[model samples]
Target: MADAELYAALGQLKLSYRECIVLQKIEGYSIKETAEILTCTEVQVRNHTERGMKALQKLLGGEIDEIG
Candidate 1:
């Protein structure tokens, strides 16, 4: 995808600064690890990730897939 499309997808996800930071900056964790680090349940982390990805797909005008 083009840079603009990529950025637009990310932007459309509406992730808070903190959420984005946690997902992108930490980078070395499995979802479970990330959830633990964030002090949230694994389900919550998965939900956010699902929502974020869905939003991105919508923004990019791509097909949306079932989350998990």
Candidate 2:
């Protein structure tokens, strides 16, 4: 998908603030770093990443490979 479409879909996911942050930041940063940035524990970061990605996956028609 195009960048614009992807971003639009992300916005439509209705994710929490932390979920968005975790998903976007985790691309280059480690879970530890993401937790630091969000001022939360590493487990929270993992949870947010997992939930956010699942929601995004569902929104994008369950295309696992397309997302990862």
- What TM value does model 1 have? 0.61
* Model 2, TM vs. native: 0.72
- Report the Cα lDDT for candidate 2: 0.63
> lDDT of all predictions, in order shown?
0.60, 0.63
Most accurate candidate by TM-score: 2
The residue-level lDDT of candidate 1 at 40 comes to 83
Q: Write the per-residue lDDT of candidate 2 for residues 1-68, one digit (tens) a residue.
A: 66665566678754563354434543667777777766888887777777777776677677645432
- Model 1: per-residue lDDT, tens digit, 1-68? 66565655565555543363346334546777777777888787777776676666766677544322
TM-score for each predicted model, relative to the true structure: 0.61, 0.72
